[model samples]
Target: MFNIDLFPQALKSDENGQTRSCLLQQTTMGESVTEQELWFAYPMNLPMPEDDDCDSYLLATLLPAMQLRAAIRVHGSVSHELLANLTELQYVWSKWLPERYFLIDIQVDRIRDQDLQVESAIAAFSGGVDAQFTAYRHATGRAGYATRDIKAGVFVHGFDIPLDDTEGFNSAVEIATQVLSDINVDLLPVKTNVRALWSIDWEEYHAAAIASVLCGLKRYAGIGLIGSGDSYDVLLTPWGSHPITDPLLSCGNFRIIHDGAGFRRSEKLIILSSWSIGIRNLRVCWAGNKHDKNCGHCEKCVRTRLNLLLAGVDNPACFDTPIDSSLFRFMVLKSDAVRIDWSLIRQEIIETGRGLEWLPYIEKVLKRKSSPKLSGLFPFGSKRRMWVKKMLMRNK
Candidate 1:
């Protein structure tokens, strides 16, 4: 059995005058695994309910790893409805990735729906295209919500940046603060070692991780907006963050909204291009270093640069250097998401009668195999090899 204990909330202030409210945890699984005093810290300056509610915090922190162990004992209050939704959501998630399927036993007190209180609206802001688009639309009243009602933007250090990297964490805070400030929104930073505590597939469990962070702030934020990674039109199965799974994460007073599903990657850029802050402070590099904002050579950075160029708003403010089309010659488009984005960029080039300049790179990408097939690993007959090649070409 896996036991999780949520200790009473504690308030602490740093030397810099910033205050943090923390919900600390202690987890143990027999003699194999033991995590003591793990914490989820939230900025305390933001508005919060009169009563301390640790239900949302427990759900967010323990749900992802519950299945890995046989049973979970959460010593905190949780919503009965939210618990049911999470149970069902886990079923759907396991179906998509059978390798991760495992039975989970849950034990916790349930909070009645009538006792829930209202909370302010907030979105996860990472200074990326998807997050920026969500913040811009919701904060500008373009999404039909009052601009001022959306209270603040939440940034998590352990999600993208490692928990131990103080330099990266500080840089992300600096960037997120500048971006949110330009839009007249407060920045709420949360620090946690949740990812380090739980050993799960990052791609498959990131949605749960993100939702947990938002839920941890449920006392302050009622509606948590999670930016969509892929648009609804081309949404593939087995994705961590989807329109279906995100909304189910809501319980009692806190609701998780999967924002920006209606817009494509290209369309989102067009919307963000109108905002100077979005253009000037966009950070999309997965290969970014602690010293540099964007490495300018990674697959993600190259893709974003191409999309910005195709959108007609490519500038030094957004990227340190111009789009190096030659980089495409070396990049192998692996995932469906990257391929889809490249396809859209390809169509844009063709429509603008600029295909000749990019034809070589596009053809190279099309000729490359789709993810490696089993046949590539073992010696196979010509017939099987030929079939795999055709499938790869057809996918392109």
Candidate 2:
């Protein structure tokens, strides 16, 4: 068993005082490190300032915190070695951290149950098709009691930022707000930077945050929600053995995480369109250059553009650069699609079986593109996965 003392100081540093992302795991020398641990640490009461604004807590604290939990759990066995050196660890964290936060988010409800006068319910506000559908349901009161009464949010802290100056998230927030407003559910946006400690796993990451929410609810029951939509169906972790584990279940991240059962990307665009989400207010680029316009060449920009095109909505401000046709081909083959395929580009992982992690997602989207059997289809796409998978298997 290998354990990294993430809290301990590193042995050396580069020109900058910045501690490399690697944690030193002091085991009896010569023991091959197996299991990995990593988590992001933030100051306590980080979300207190915006307790009333659920969106702030969810975006700033919950989303980032939960993603750190997912990273420790999902990629533990696969990237355990990524934690070997400080500079190496930082490099891996640079990519892995953002992937973890891809669609992480949360929602809250303070309601009166038969047994208790007041209880707190927490759900993820995944910016995907499934989450969009759930938000719609909460709006019209399809099931029981009209409208979801949620008020908080979360994210993998700085995970929202891009590795390089690539793009922005204006559109994402605009879509999110439009969804919340329709359902009368207040969306809280929180930013999290919990992946700083890469030695701890997802369980502990959520334990701290979930624990914080539980504390926030005080006497009320703490609820962690898993929601619906098409993106949920496409993701392997959304349904199976995700890294989040019990922490995802403590209040339960499983309950709300549905598999492609609700909304599609097209419908979401239509809904947002109805709300008049202008191109400038929406952001989907994640290149790290906040001021720079979207790098249409990146996988993310292309995907967003394709989704919008399929939806029949036109707005150029969201992404200024016209995506190169070659860039689209590269993205189709996993160029810069994060969370879904970003892991494939990792220098080390690319040499392995999962050539580009997004191959599978691309495969899913391809099957749905321009298909006669498809219903309510707009457009989100992918491919080149079989060849990559075959190559990855051959190396072994």
Q: Who wins the TM-score comparison?
A: 1
Please give, for residues 1-396, the per-residue lDDT of candidate 2 as tens digits: 222222222223234212212232323236555333222222233222112212112211333333443222120111111112112322333454555533322212331112222344444453443344444444445536523444433322233342121233344444566646654654543333333323234322433333333222322223444443224334433222232332232321112222223344554565555444333435455432342345555556666665555455554556666533454343333211233433322322234333244345444444332324221131111124334434644552
Instruction: List runs of model 1 lying over 4 Å from the truth.
Output: 1-33, 47-54, 61-63, 66-69, 145-148, 351-356, 370-396
Q: What is the TM-score of each candidate against the true structure?
A: 0.82, 0.44
Q: How many residue-pair clashes does candidate 1 contain?
A: 0
Residue 264, candidate 2: Cα error in Å is 3.1
| For model 1, the run of ten residues with the poorest summed lDDT | 373-382
What does each candidate score in C-alpha RMSD?
A: 8.2, 15.4
How well does candidate 1 match the true structure in TM-score terms? 0.82
- The lDDT, on a scale of 0 to 1, for candidate 1 is 0.68
The deviation in Å at residue 156 for candidate 1 is 1.1
